[model samples]
Target chain A: MPYYRCVVPKDSVPYEQRAAVAKAFTDIHCGNTGAPRSFVHVVFDEADDRWATPYFLDGGNRAGRSEEVKAELLSDLMGAFREITGVAEEDFSGRITEGPAKWTMEGGMVLPEPGEETEEWYSHGQAAAGG
Target chain B: MSRVSFNCTMQEGQIGEELRAELAAALQQITQDVLGESPDDVPVTFSDIPSGYGFRGGEPSTTSLVRGSIVGGVTQEVREDFMRRICDSWMEISGCTVDELVVSARDV
Candidate 1:
């Protein structure tokens, strides 16, 4: 479960850029972690004004990944946002928070811990992908 | 104090007011049945993400998220059961596919 929320100024990101960022994020997340593409959720919210930067990526993922992976994932995500939206580095920031896998369920099954994925889980993902 | 509360977020125009009421009542009933939390004490809220504001797998998303926070968390078995019931009832009442929903019973 990797849910990425892009918090930006109101009306700052148009629909085309938002769609591009979402696609890029899905690619980056699935590429970094062997997780299913379907499990990655990207949403844009222009409602929050609390961040120091004009753009922020608020991400949530299932726990158990190494710090290295998590750090790289966040960096890659922020980079994608900037590359797609042409936002300056100073205007963008990001962080990914983790929670236990057992605490969530997708496709009617409890999510397996990272690296503990079963073929069944992969099958569900495949089906959702329309494979 | 209530033992559980749920925040259900959906895409705009996916479910109407009538279905939302049914879904909320079903969630409260499930809380009572699974976790023994009184329906009166269970607080359920629903919000909608405006169209074009949500995406999944690089496409516009029809998915909804149901996040439940339990004060004193239950065991994994109970947690799974709780999520399963919510999934079943949500799909039944809302007519959404399993892939269109994400249910989390987080321990707070």
Candidate 2:
């Protein structure tokens, strides 16, 4: 009963790649859960408003912060997002919303289980300094 | 002992290690409930991070990647309801804020 669907716009992805991800999604999870492929739907939402990015904040033994430093940190994530997702530009919805996001998973429109790891990550992260 | 990093800050008791293990199951269950597919049919995976190292989950996945579920297509009010219910439960275990949350919804 798994239905994997992509919520992406045509402009953001080429048909072939999109299809490939869906297939990969199904191949990985399908049958393992004893569910039919038709039941799974993986969605890819092509968003022009924001891009996934990572910023290194200032911490003695940790990463650094500062616009320039943040830019330096985000360089890799920016490249990775484009390379992996085939996105054309980079823009964080941080301002449109507020504060830049480490990735879209936290800021974007997504739903995972409450006790899920992502929530754990969030709770753990909230405990850390410079959140 | 500071190898991990986090996307946001949180309280220690807010999110727990036990729930971390349960996340993958929860995400799988959520997708399965909406799509009516078996757990295998759910493509999304849930990962967790420990310690105060910061950040949750594993590494950031590339965008060329296509990852999302059908449950995201539910009505806004219904979706909010789902998130709200979960948030209430999550808050007890960990320190997750209601704001700065996102729900993925893409047209297939």
Name the top lDDT candidate: 1
Question: What stretches of model 2 exceed 4 Å from their correct place?
Answer: A1-131, B1-17, B47-68, B71-74, B92-102, B106-108
Q: Which numbered prediction scores highest in DockQ against the true structure? A: 1
Give the per-residue Cα lDDT of candidate 2 at A129.
Answer: 16
Residue-level lDDT for A82 in candidate 1: 96
State every prediction's TM-score relative to the real structure. 0.97, 0.29
Q: Which is the leading candidate under TM-score?
A: 1
User: What does candidate 1's lDDT look like per residue over B3-91, in tens digits?
Assistant: 79999989989988889889999999999999888899998999998899899888898999999999764788898899999999999
Ten contiguous residues minimizing lDDT sum, candidate 1 chain B: B71-80
DockQ of each: 0.88, 0.07
CA error at residue A21 for candidate 1, angstroms: 0.6
lDDT of 2 by residue, A1-131 (tens): 12222334435555455555445544443323322233233343433322343211111101112455334323433343344455555332111111212112332223332223254444433343123
Q: Report per-candidate TM-score of chain A alone.
A: 0.96, 0.33
Q: Considering only N, C-alpha and C atoms within 3 Å, which residue pairs clash in candidate 1?
A: none
**Residue B10 lDDT in candidate 2:** 29
